[model samples]
Target: MLDWDDLRIFLAVARAESLSRAGRALKLDAATVGRRIARLEEEMSAKLFVKSPQGYALSEAGDRLLPHAEAAEQAFAGAQEELSGAAGQLTGQLRIGAPDGCANYLLPQVCARISDANPGLEVQIVALPRVFNLSKREADMAITVSRPTAGRLTVQKLTDYHLHLAAHREYLANSAPLTCKADLRGHRMIGYIPDMIFDKELDYFAETEAQVVGLASNSASVQTRMVQSGAGVGIVHDFAIPFAPGVVRVLADEVSLKRAFWLIRHADDRRSERLTRFAEALGQGLRDEVTRLERLAADTTLAGL
Candidate 1:
């Protein structure tokens, strides 16, 4: 005899990791969310979450209940969409997890277009420095650089994009000559901290002998910015060049990297037609963006020549 409203609240709180955040999402006050959690725990006769300074962490019972709640939510959404007589009528929030680069440069435009078409849908982008955990329900869908090896998830290759060693024109003009890869050692370089790299696929410097980074950050966007500011040279995505106006590819003949993005979602949610369409839209958007990136890279290369 548990209330569906309570389960909805519980799911929101678990996802947001804070009562205040869940309340804002649900359009309820924080006090109301707290009262509902208290009621839910009383009805279930078990504590659901651990209240802490870092926000709410799900207890063992809450973790066990999460999948059931998500399943129920999906069922309700399917029924609602079917009853409305439009498979395109999606009315729930989809949280997408992705690396900082894609989250900042790609998904905002993509999600905006999707949300415009589906007026009832909300898209939340969770930009993380590391890989997203689909099994933990960290996101409804994720865009990953590396293909997951183990998980009950549906994954698709979105698109392949290129990265190149780049530096600001001003930096190149003002600093040492870089006629060869060996010259990289003498220049101030911006890159990710070696110890903080979360995935092997992101280890762009692995093969290089460069041992020093003048400035380090976990975010590709930040590194791009530093390079744009003429702080140092760094590797940047071809697509991201549009943002860094003065940044230009250097050592193009010697340094070109290719990487791909994979879209992933829970296996059980594959039957959700709305989710499927959204994922497809994401793939198409990325493909279009990759095409643009290729053209840009070609143009830049020609200009440099």
Candidate 2:
């Protein structure tokens, strides 16, 4: 029979694609991790991973073993939940991957509230510009701008948020008068690097005439800072506007964009009561927070007028 402990180590290495990384995650030394993997391979008489300069790539046998191992892992998690009784509090670490914009502006307060309610829970937010690979266990769950069309995943639409062309008050004051979209061409534009835009929804300027980006970054937080510094105008999330003082909507009526955040998870994880409870709390928290922030943004804009 395959040892569950060895299988656990194998899963870690497979997900991390490196013995050192797996060891760090499992709190085992790299040599020990390698020995365990070698032992598992010998017992099965199949090479599970191929070491390359890039890292460990799973061999065909490893790929074939993945689903079974994941299923066993889930089964163990379910067993633990059952044995622990109804604790009414989630424990262990839950990592969520999200785009930098949402990560910076929304998750802080939202996660704080969640953590406050569940003292046993540890929440981690992995902010990156690219899509997270749930299949590789990159994160426990992910927040995305668009629903994924392919994957063994389940998605829930969290909330619809607004974005608009915005600039610092000083920038607008010093620059030439802007009366219409046509005038945007004369102003310095701040936005994402065209090639670095990972999602179609993030291509905010593609449909607009502001083709030239004088200040560009892949991070929304960076772009927001650039705009807040009176560098240039850019499309900024309404929920984020209140956080950027002196930043106001430039052409709210003429230029507006709406996008939604989606919560995605491995389809099989729905069976876990712990994750279900956390997901419920996270969804509600995010929805409420977005609404509150957007209202604050609108009020801030109106008050400044």
Where does model 1 exceed 4 Å of error? Answer: 13-64, 83-89, 135-137, 302-305
Q: Write the per-residue lDDT of candidate 1 for residues 1-305, one digit (tens) a residue.
A: 87778999999899888999999989999999999999999999999999999999999999999888888888887777678754556667789999999998888888887788888788899999987776556888899999988878898999999888888888888887887777889888888988999878888975454668889999999999999999988888888887788888887778788999999899989887878988988899889977876677655541231
Model 1: pairs clashing at backbone N, Cα or C within 3 Å: none
Model 1: how far residue 68 lies from native, Å? 2.6
**For candidate 1, what is the TM-score?**
0.84
Against the reference, the lDDT scores of all candidates come to 0.85, 0.88
Using all chains and alpha carbons, the TM-scores for the candidates as numbered come to 0.84, 0.93
Model 2: how far residue 101 lies from native, Å: 0.4
Worst 10 residues of 1 by lDDT: 296-305
